[model samples]
Target: MKDFLELLQRGARKRISLAELRQHYFSLYPDVQNSPDRSARLLETLRQLETIGALSLPAVGSWEKIGVPPLPQWVLLKREPKAVPRKDFGNVAWAPELGFWPELRPGQLETLLPINEFLLRRRGSLMVVPIKERSLEIYGDEKRLDGMCTGDSLFGGRLHLNTLGCFRVPQPLPYRMADAPGKPVLVVENHNSFWSFGEWNQQARCYSAIVYGSGDAFRLTGRALQQVLGQVAGSGAEYLGDLDPKGVRIPGEFNRSAEVGSPQVSPALVFYQWLLAHGVRRHRAECVSFDAASLERWLGAELAAQVAKVWQSEHWIPQESLGFEQLSAGVL
Candidate 1:
């Protein structure tokens, strides 16, 4: 590129026509003068010069040497030839229930052919093994399809392994068990709070379990409580969260949104009252609609009144305030 620019400066004028620029460039490299991609290759270098403020196309098919720039070492790369799209691949046949992705890039099926062929050779035999086991059998390496089954990750979401007859067990709901049947579990929102309750409850057997609510995750995973109740008949559940707008809303919203006959969720009223009394109130950068009626309806009028006053005072009591120390003290 430096040689090309220096050649133009020596033999060419301030303003050179495209033909003159090509003549100077070809004269410097006579080998590529007649190459099929000569014009494209030369244009790429010309674009580099134009980018560095050394040249400008003031008029069509004309070049203007704007200024001489201190040359930075520039590497000229030859563009790779575009791959020719395959006219077609041989007919692919998997089980009638399973098929190739609905959408294929110009030549994607050709790359994906071997996997389909392996499935076809199996004679429609479906899954008996776990997803990773099936993945190892098909691809000779496990985890090739891991985490690719969701939201366009697997072949653009055209197929899921489970839908393709490969069994993938869903992860079980995460929880800490107390093994105290027929007792209510306390589902704590924050991890520290869950740990405090989980460790204390293990010895005290105050709850059948101490479940980590995992914040918003509990809204969806609350059904796990049903699985808990199934094993511990006549058991119920209470929830403890930070004394914030979201905390107050979580239980009420979970109950309202859950399907009928879903497990009952109630506030751990005694703990919440204890939190009001002992938990330090801190100002937090939280965004929530301060709905007094919702608070009153969710917490009974008494506690709801205290929580509302806290909100009005612009402070909150996070569940973490009642840590292992407080629970271990057996004060509440």
Candidate 2:
């Protein structure tokens, strides 16, 4: 999956040799799934990676056993404090911090990461191309943005590091009311749920909105949840996530480590009803599946039981499958 490859690239520091990856992934895979059936899946994933140019194959073993090319050299060397000449390194990229690489173009450079975005900003608009990666930076000088700080904007520009920046978004100021001053705050686990906060303004007025950009942000986002718990007077607050297991577990894990007296809520049935009403099929991708009823039944019977008993399970569901419309109705 794209998520898994991106995770590899991010943690491996741009590229990792093939041998290193086998050990890493093998360790993470469930022992029960380590047979030929799973190996087939692994090979399929590697082929997908090759098709996307995310993984390179150098006349060798399985495509999975290859090394990613050096991050195109220019990305590392361009970080020098001193300015360099804009010589036509012909066939070379013009990325500011990444310098020039034979394989890169102006459009592709920004997709590297936040640090690269900052570097490219310094490089000016002298024709640069990037690869097929997501970029969050506001490019070009003409279309200025508001309600955004440039320094913070650069931080937010990174697909990975934005975890920290989302934390800095405006927090609801502490308030003293006639009722219990603080109830438990709802921690939304992804950007879509966080964005949906606008539609639930009336409901949200009764609670604080804390955004954790991804399921991966559970630990970091837990800090914000802690802040709300400490500041609020009572523990009437509740947490909500998608109907899937991943959604169920994040808040459950956060509650275990961070808070007290709050309930973990799943709107699986609500989404199931909505899907039936609206006529949508569950889309399948990687670990995320849209079969709300099936997932709901599985979670209620197997996954929840496992969580309640074993305290460890890999069941995860992506909130995006329900679509924003259903999410706005609080069905995530």
**Candidate with the greatest lDDT versus the true structure:** 1
Cα RMSD for predicted model 1:
14.9
**TM-score for all predictions?**
0.50, 0.32
lDDT (Cα, tens digit) per residue for candidate 1, span 89-205: 444554443355435542345335555766677755775666677666765656544533442135555665554446444334556777688888788888887778889988888
lDDT of 2 by residue, 1-332 (tens): 43345346556254455455555445444221323334444555566566655665444432433233211111111111222123343643334434333443322232233435455554443333221111234323211122222322322342322322232332332322223345445445566765554345334355533334356466334444445556655454444455444655455555554434433333334433343344323433333433334443435654444323222222333445555465556653
RMSD of every prediction = 14.9, 17.1
The top-ranked prediction according to TM-score is 1
lDDT of 1: 0.66
Error of 1 at 123 (Å): 5.6
Candidate 2, overall lDDT? 0.40
**Whole-model lDDT per candidate:** 0.66, 0.40
